[model samples]
Target: MATRDTHNLRSVLAVRGFRRLLGVRLSSQLADGLFQAALAGSVLFNPDRQTSAMAIAAGSALLVTPYSLIGPFVGVFLDRWSRRQLVVFTNLLRAALVLPAAALINGGGKGVAFVVVAFAIIGLNRFLLAGLSAAVPHVVEDRRLVTANSLSGTLGSICFSAGLGIAVLLINVLVSAGDSGYAVMALVAPIGYVASALLAWRSFRVDELGPDHVTAPKRAPMHSAIGDVVRGMGDGLAHLASKRGAAYTMAAKAGFRALFGVLTLAMLLLYRNYFVTDDDVHDSITGLAFVVVAGTLGVMVAALVTPPVTRRIGGWRWVAGLIAGIAIALPLTVSSFTQPLLVVAVFCVNIAAQGTKIVVDTSIQHECDDDYRGRVFAVNDTTYNLSYVLGLFAAALTLPADGHSPTAVFIVAAGFALIAGWYAVVAGRWARRVGDDIAQPDPVPTPVG
Candidate 1:
């Protein structure tokens, strides 16, 4: 099975159009990481900037919540435009917007101007991502679509992480230069976006990443587009209601993402206000970077182990076991938190998070009809980000400035325990009842919208 998966992956990588599209994804995501890191540094880790848990939550809300709300519907318009052109336009817009965002950072402008530009850039980033996902089917063959998505998505994540690491390094190296230095770092990200735009423009025809000619239509009016989203979401939920295994596992995934967000907020506070003493923002950023590294390593481990492990124990069992492991391990590592323990805790949490995600995605693919799969994912993506934001706000209300609340940590563990218990009891039974009947379905072609 591993060998076959490998062959499929290689076959997808061999396609010229797919390779070009993958290049666009990598470079665009790399810029995303760079921009995100810069924003985090300017807002959270700046020595001169004072912040609290609530402030952090508000910042997160401002940056992420809109994406959660508006992202699902953006696909309505994606179907109307040529995806390749949309990609090119969005990358160019991001590049243009970064200048003001950088300037605002340079001048220390956290006022409305800065906020608007920042919001626009991030919103456009979301739009770009939706377009990219929609374009995948046009570049890859039908048979290898799953492998194509897996390879491209995995490599895109690595590129984003690389960009993040680079930005953090720049922040630390320019610690003395402060906001000015961070502004310079922000300037670096546009080069990536511009390069991505150029790749898209030069490598692919305007209609190459496309809504096929037969299905393509004029842009829907705003009201009509919104109505479509509402109807699609309802239909998606109905489909999930009938697919018990997928629905249960998806609920588990949302719960995990929310808890992960809570832990993330706690970690950020701990690093910024508790672990690093006196205004040493450099070491604070470094500590957080270490957590990222540990989590990334754990994600890598989960990716390597999950397929074979799930094949043996089954998806639900593997997912239930991973969450159960996290439930048992989190409080043990996080309650008496030290820097090393922080890394260990993040490592364990991501293993569960990514492992569950793999199973959940697979379950959705297997259980959902192809027509409904895209909308199910739209619902899934909406809940995923919203849950994370919800967790942030929930934690903000309860967590102290120093983020050293054993109570909060334990509560998170309890939350995980509950999710694991539900998965075990509900999803586990469903998996057992189905037995060996569960099988992979044909890849659902990526919807243009």
Candidate 2:
């Protein structure tokens, strides 16, 4: 077994390419944070907007569903094109898309135009992120993947939260409590996106972050891209099917995400409506923001602890335990709808969710072939976004205006328990099939241009 000292984050960051990649990841996520916060504030919390659990679910669906629908196909391009170029082009495109979105918000437009543009921007974001995940192995050694993922994912999350905070502050300082504030906040995201694009352009040579030089088919006509995408997605799924461990890990992560989505939507409704009487929008937003802050702290702690814990208990077992932890923690912490208890629930769930994510990411990176990594991660992304949307819709149906539904919480807990059991069975079967391969250390492959 490798000692703790070997996987230290400082040693991983010492790699120049990884450091540059981290910069791109952090910058892009910060922009996403700002963009999402601005959109949420405009759509859900503006005084002119009618806020309800159903509306919140609709908003969440709008932001995520397009990516869920189109993200898998986009992964095809990730494998065919230069990922470094994808990172650069996608960010630049996103910056352009944000312009119309910001204008629509400023002009009080809320129909199809706004939704279409917003959807496109987020869809591009999915491609950019998948490329980054696929490129991570190229930038760092396999032995250091856990530490690298922990640092990048955890810190990128922090940057996102920081960006949201900055957007809120910008709104307060720049404009009134209506559409104009949201509009101005939307403008901030473009700056971050442009900066991220430049960083990506300057960070790596063309094809340095790669699809391993395998012969890829020539780009099809525009009319055939969709067909290509479907075939490509099928291929990706087949590849993952062969790697049972990665496939099951994604399934477990999807279940955890669905439960987390329920918790998120419920908490948003709780703060926006139930926690504060008299519809005090400001206080409700403040309460939700505090919960986010607490969750961020919990994510940091999870990053600190997960590497060691995964090392101690195999990554698969550790993920199973975290999933089980959610089932146990959810009912215990959130059955009562008080603010203090909800804060605790948020903190605990974030730890489990983030820890599970770290394990799943590292396991996929280790177990899956490099050539198929982007598509696999794209499928993983699709699973997460779609499952969360499903959970949101489910919560919208069951949750009352007050968001105090122990029944709903219990249902989610039950789902978590079922998922945990499924993960255990899958892990055991995979272990038996692979024998000691999971335990044996393999040298990182040489990078392909």
Candidate 3:
């Protein structure tokens, strides 16, 4: 099974366009990691800042919510526009936007100018990600999408972590310089964005990665067109409703992410206030970096584990079982609250998260029409971030400064168990009624040029 999976992966990688698209995703995600690390250092972990659970959670909400609200609306354009062009343009724009943001950090300016620039960069990131996901079907054969998504998403995640590690190292090296150090770290992110843009510009023709069918009104006035696009979100939702498997998988992912968010905040506070037990913010950064590495390694493990397991038992069952496993394991690993044990917990949770995401993404890509794919993915991204932010705030209300709350861990565990059971029951009934064998693979196509 492992040998066959490896062959399938190699086959997917051999496709020229898949390789290029994967490059675009990797470079873009790497920049995401770098920019996020710099933001975390400047906003949350700076020695000058007084950090707490509520403050951190609020900051996270502020950074995520505005873009999330507009994500679905943005999807309308993704369906109308050339995705390759969108990828290239958004990357260049992000690169341009980061400069002033970095300069603001350099001058220790955390005012409106910094916030506005930072929000613009993050908003463009959402568009780039949705465009990338929607473009996957254009690059790979239908039968190979599961493997392609696993490889692309997992590798992208690892590269993002790599960027984080790199930025963190730079910040630590220049810790004496304070805000200027973080500013310098942020400037490094644009290089990745430019590389991604250049690769996309060079690798494919203008129309290669596409919304093959454009359904927007041709001659409508600008305001009227804007209204139609907003209304188009309903069409996307209606289309999603018809694809029960994809809808169920997306719901499961949203539930899992909310719980993941709670745990994430707990982990951060633990490192900052509990594990380090000292004044130096650098210690907390180092500790948190280890946890992030553990999680990234676990995501890689899932890329290997999920394809074969889903092939054996089907994607939905595998997803439910993985979530169940996390429910049972989380309390035990987190109850002790020791750094080593928490690392193990993070590793296990990410395996479940990434494995579920791989299945969810594949199911959506396979089931939905290309016309609505962008909006569906936009909805997907919005739900993903919103659930996470809500979870963060919810946990913040219960968590203390040191992040020690056994009750919180147990409650999260129970929530995971409920999500697993709900998904299993709902999805099982739907599959039976629809007579769809989701486990069945599509026949592999001849290799692409």
- Which number leads on TM-score? 3
RMSD of 3: 2.8
Q: Mind sharing the TM-score for model 1?
A: 0.86
Query: Which 10-residue window of candidate 3 scores lowest in summed lDDT?
Result: 435-444
Best by lDDT: 3
| Count of backbone collisions within predicted model 3 | 0
Each prediction's Cα lDDT score? Answer: 0.78, 0.82, 0.88
| lDDT (Cα, 0-100) at 62 in candidate 3 | 78
On residues 98-143, what C-alpha lDDT tens digit does candidate 3 reach at each position?
9999999878747878777888898899889899999999999877
Worst 10 residues of 2 by lDDT: 435-444
Indicate the residue-level lDDT of 201 in model 1.
97
TM-score of 2: 0.93
User: Per-residue lDDT of 1-449 in model 1, one digit per residue for the tens?
Assistant: 77766766677778899999999999999998898888778888776678889988887778777767866555444544577888898999999999989999988848888878888888787677656765676776544544555456566767888888998877756544367877888899999999999999999987788645414454879898678777766666788898999888889899988998899898888998888768988788778778878877777777666655665567788888999899999888988888998799988887787777767666665676654655565566767878988899998998888888999988999999999898889987786787631333345789896
Any runs in candidate 2 off by more than 4 Å, and if so which? 1-7, 214-227, 436-449
- Tens-digit per-residue lDDT, 37-143, candidate 2: 87888877777767778877887788789888777877777777788888998899999999999999888748889888888888788778778988999988887
